[model samples]
Target: MNIIPILASAGITGFESPAAEYSQLGCNLDELLIEHPSATFIGKACGDSMQGVGIFDGDLLIVDRHVTPTHQDVIVANFNGEFVCKLLDIKRRLLLSANEKIQPVVINDFDTFSIEGVVIRSIRCHRPSPLLSNK
Candidate 1:
């Protein structure tokens, strides 16, 4: 059997709305966005080095530790004890930036480095959001 979902625009002020007509109780953002809950984490992007890939400063990043990092994949890593987000070049042993202004970094044997996780999802806030602000 085929099931068709009805489009809805619910606007209720403390009263029971027509939401009961829907099959599911509600939609959960966590359920939709997160795949591996235990291996997932969220971080805020602090620089424009990844702006070319649409990950701007102050954007919310959802990193997943369970996934393996492939070549040219956007990833978070611990480079010389500091956490940074960059594009991984597995074969070249380099960390690349999405923005042209930023140069790619070479991973040398002397430099301590480890891939932390993959950046699976990103969220951008057009307006100032209280959740992302220090206030």
Candidate 2:
């Protein structure tokens, strides 16, 4: 969903070669990208506040609740009853942003905040999917 579209150019296949030994290879993406499947969930980013970190609006966020968040880790959290994505500054107890224009949010004692998960992966779509509405 950051899917870098490859510009496929036209190519020519001169002649059919003899049938050599062939094998089918299996590729499971989940095994490569996910560590904790049951504890992981995917969410879509919805704002321009984290573009500097390569997480843009409409990017698919793979958040893992089982993973412990570290300092400066990008995370999804329930901030005041709503979900938000931000950088976790544990020492300062604040939510920071990659974009300079977006101000950091301090976590006060009165605020209702809970860390939902640590953002492990994010996907961006370079082109619209055929399954989705065409623009």
Error of 2 at 105 (Å): 0.4
lDDT of 1 at 117: 95
Note the Cα lDDT for every prediction shown.
0.89, 0.86
Off by over 4 Å in 2: 1-26, 130-135
RMSD of candidates 1 onward, in order: 6.5, 6.2
Against the correct fold, how does model 1 do in TM-score?
0.79
Give one digit per residue, the lDDT tens place, for model 1 in 30-127.
87678999999999999899999999999999999999999999999999999999999999999999999999999999999998899999998889
Predicted candidate 2 versus true structure: per-residue lDDT over 1-135, tens digit per residue: 122224333576454432333343354668757899999998889899999899998888999999999999999999999999999999999999999998999999999999999999999888876653324
TM for every model, in the order presented, reads 0.79, 0.77
Clashing pairs in 1: none
